[model samples]
Target: MVRAGFYLLAIMGFSVSGALGADAVERAVASCWACHGAGAAPKDPTMPIIQGQQAAYLEKQLDAFRSGKREDQIMSSMAESIPARENARAAAMIAALAWPKVAGAATAPAPDSAIACQSCHGADFTGGPGPEGVAPRLAGQFAQYLEARMGAFSRGEIASAATMTAMMKALDADERAKLAKYLSGL
Candidate 1:
């Protein structure tokens, strides 16, 4: 009888632990999908498509957003609710999802604007090389986030010392919009 009781208790314990783990993963994924849907595009033009991004890069960005090191109202707000370890797990999940192709019309920047951006952001806008340190992979980033950053740079919210800020200053509103659209499609 004691042996049977112990067996029952063990089974219950295993079931409870399994449920909790499943719940954690589900919650984490739901939180992320609120912004990055499996197939749905963001309502705002500024939000980037996080699906299919590098897990490490996504984790770093989430950490930055959570820490307030990267300032963006929506991202910061979303990151706030996620714990550090959970954020890493969520980022990994998002990174594993497939990226959707750019839908709708393709908007190209003016020749002059294109030239200006290529000087730093690269002709492809995949960002410059440097795993150790340098430009980030801007390709397929959330459009809203990119636009917000550009706007911040233009308004001097981002310091001029930052290379991004300097480049952003060179772009007018039209150019900024064009760049955001182009980069998001990548």
Candidate 2:
């Protein structure tokens, strides 16, 4: 009974009155609830988590996709579909969100290649300083999603980051899988 009340209370905050009174940021944040899942923790393994991604990083990626610098059939079209003016607003909206909980994360071990990764992805893989500023967080990514991306980089299908290409190549397919598996579980 209490849980139901709590849910009702939460929903009420997003009710017509609340929504009608919301500012731009609130509306923008709500726009992502569809494909990215309710709060940006994607249920699909093919989707990347954007709930707590760095604003700059997300903006850069969006730009890359829009400009054809990064080639993802879905993202390229999606990025282009949005007006350039709204890019920063969307990124900021997503970035302001908290990182979702990673169940069983404590039981996950770091892969051998995680140290090399830390230079860019940070010690916690929750992002940190990079030569370019912000690096995307990879702590709880989906293995399949990570694997596909690493493979694309290794094969030169995606060359946005030369460093990532080199790293993926050095890891090889097996090591990449291991790294992805470990990181995703976190």
The regions of model 1 sitting more than 4 angstroms off are 1-23, 72-74, 109-123, 127-137, 140-145, 159-161
Residue range 98-149, candidate 2, lDDT tens digits: 8775444433566677899888898888886697467788888777888898
Top lDDT model: 2
Best by TM-score: 2
User: Over the full model, what C-alpha lDDT does candidate 2 score relative to the true structure?
Assistant: 0.77
- The estimated TM-scores of all candidates read 0.66, 0.77
Q: What is the RMSD, in Å, between candidate 1 and the native fold over all Cα?
A: 4.7
RMSD of each: 4.7, 10.7
Per-model CA lDDT versus the true structure: 0.68, 0.77
Per-residue lDDT of 1-186 in model 1, one digit per residue for the tens? 999999999999999987787677667668766656557666555566677666766777788888887787888877866655677777777766776665663554453565666655566665544433334556666666777778988888754236666667777887787777777666
Give per-candidate clash totals.
9, 0
